[model samples]
Target chain A: MTYCVALKLDRGLVMMSDTRTNAGLDNISTFRKMHVWEKPGERVLTLMTAGNLATTQAVISILDERMKAPEEREPSIFAAPSMFQVARIVADTLREVIGRQADSGQKADAAFNATVLLGGQIAGGPVRLFLIYPEGNFIEASDDTPFFQIGETKYGRPILVRAFERTMSFEAAVKLLVVSFDSTIKANLSVGMPLDVALYEEGSLSLGTPWRMEANDAYYRTISEGWGDALKQAFDRLPDMELPTSG
Target chain B: MTYCVALKLDRGLVMMSDTRTNAGLDNISTFRKMHVWEKPGERVLTLMTAGNLATTQAVISILDERMKAPEEREPSIFAAPSMFQVARIVADTLREVIGRQADSGQKADAAFNATVLLGGQIAGGPVRLFLIYPEGNFIEASDDTPFFQIGETKYGRPILVRAFERTMSFEAAVKLLVVSFDSTIKANLSVGMPLDVALYEEGSLSLGTPWRMEANDAYYRTISEGWGDALKQAFDRLPDMELPTSG
Candidate 1:
């Protein structure tokens, strides 16, 4: 299991994902789920994956392989002309990977399915966010839905829906996501740290280096503990339930 | 779909459920999910249902019917000598309902399954809480796991986990659940107002009249709005994410 989130803010893009993955309670390992591709002064792309690890890894590897052989007829994510095209490439790669798994005798839909969150900016295109599903279809975030969350999304979603603001400062966006991730990590054993977070300024055509937040990171600790305390305080301040005499 | 939560606190028990049920988005309807059977000063039991409406209503009808036939051979819920026995009766009723459906050519497990939250105090037993699955098995809440949430539970879970304290006042518990329910309602269309909440004080041998929280309820508004503001405030106060210079 994994938990990944990306926000398309007015000022830029903020993406975050946890590194922990597990096949079962007894088999746990750490693997980076967030990837970046940068072409300074031209474009920047970020990808966060969830669902089947094999499928996601295969998709990433194929995209990376295509990038190396520029003369290839196939499309690579880096070669996409627009963010939409980038999403299409990622979705196609995901489909191809799943298809291969099915050819190898695995259940294509259940065993090899993967979902990806793609966010980036092309040289001439505006910043965009898309959630690519297992079927090679995707949905772009809009003004009404300015963010995308995948993998164990429900535990962390209430806080995001309650707190997210498209116009908030990038720093606040990062803080909000950290808190949301923290909430998820605490509630479910499947999603853990160190968490990877990236901040990309719109139209800069450059990807910000990602930050890895370990379990003991200062900000992580503050958000985890502080959010708990703040919640209790908030609960205490709420007015009491006033059931009338008959009810 | 529905959202129901039951908390086993040191002071007593808090149970809540939303009434919305739907076959499809267009076929949504309101149906009470919380049922109360209180024999004043003798015992109090609240049954909250989730899953297929037909299965739950069938189970409830059977139980209610058995109660009327005092000379019946079957063990009725009201006749149960202990809370454990009560849980067994409820589970047995659920299994019976499903089994009957299967015998009538329905896909019992898929089409007729219903999960129930059975909680109450019997005359001789301590305040007890149990989550009865469709398979006629059940698990009671313990000190470690003092709560059970069924249906659309994930969205409201984080707040409960963060704020739930066994020693907290009953009013606080009620407030916490309202906020949790409010969060779930905002994020999910299938779970909505009016919400039902019931309180049981240990040893009271009686149940409080349940409160019905409607869409425009003042307290619900306060929580829906107040919680959002409080979360933003908390996020704002968190120390900024100290991403490395490159991030």
Candidate 2:
């Protein structure tokens, strides 16, 4: 299990992913789930994946191979004309990789499966965020639901539901996201840290410097401490029930 | 969908359940999920059900019928020797009702489909809480995990993970529970008001007067407002990312 979130805010795009993977509780391991493909000022695309780690890594490796063999691929992530076309390129690459893996006579239950949070900006268009499903189909974030979450999503859903908005400042958005991730991390052992967070300004063609929040990072510490204190204070403020004297 | 939680604390027991049921998003209705059976001084039992509404209703009907036919039944909830025995009776009745309904072919899928949170105190026993699975088996709450939630549980899990403790005061437990419920309600539309809350002090054989909190209830209003504000404050206190100037 993993937890990854991407937000399409007016200021820009914010993407975060946890780095823990477990085949079972005893086989837990850390793996980077965020992959960035950058072509300087032309295009910048980031892919955060969840679901079967082998499938996701295979898909990423295939995409990287395509970028290297530029003669064979005309519409790779590096050359896509727009963000929408770039998303199409990603979906196509994922489908092909999954198909190749499935054709190897693997057991039916062991078929390749992965979902990706694709977010980036092209020089000519707006920053966009998409949640690509295992079937290679995808949905873009819209005004009503301006964010997408994949993998172990429910534990972190409350903060996003209550606080996310199109008009939120980028700073507030990132903070809310960290708090959300903190909640998820505490509740689920499958989602651990060394969080990868990327913020893209709306018009910037290149991605901003990605932040790696390590375990015991001071900012995450503040978020966790503050949240715990706030919950206690909130609990204290709620009115107590006035029970009847007779039982 | 529904959300029901019951906690076993050192001083008492706390139980709360939402009243929303939906066949689909288009077919929504309110159906109380909490049921109480008390012989006052002899025994007190509360059951909160989540899952197929028809199946839970059938189970409740069976229990009610057994009470009505006391002459034929060797032991009813009113006559059960201990809370543990009462839980077995509840689980068995649930399975029997569901089995009978399936045999009639009215709804085969509904067979033994409801999960229940059963909690109460018998005249001579300690307060006990059990989580009854659809298979008619159950697990009692222990010191490590002192609370049980039956439906739409993930959205509310973070608060409980951070706040619940074996020695929490009864007042603190109830407030923590309301905040947890508020988080779930905000995240999922399928779980809603009014909420039924029952608090039973340890060694008390009967429940204290249960409170029905409606959408506009003052205490609930405070919980919603206070919790949202508290979360935002917590978010603000988190440290901002200090990313390197160049990637």
The list of candidate 1 runs beyond 4 A from truth reads A245-247
Best by lDDT, which number?
A: 1
Worst 10 residues of 1 chain B by lDDT: B238-247
User: A8-52, model 2: which lDDT tens digit per residue?
Assistant: 888888889999999889999999999998888888899999988
Q: What is the C-alpha lDDT of each candidate?
A: 0.88, 0.82
Q: What is the C-alpha RMSD of each candidate to the true structure, in Å?
A: 1.6, 2.7
Give the TM-score of each candidate: 0.97, 0.91
lDDT of 1: 0.88
Q: What's the lDDT for residue B247 in model 1?
A: 37
Write model 2 residue lDDT over B121-160, tens digit each, in one string.
8887888899988778899998888889998999999889
Interface alpha-carbon RMSD, every candidate: 2.1, 2.9
Best by TM-score: 1
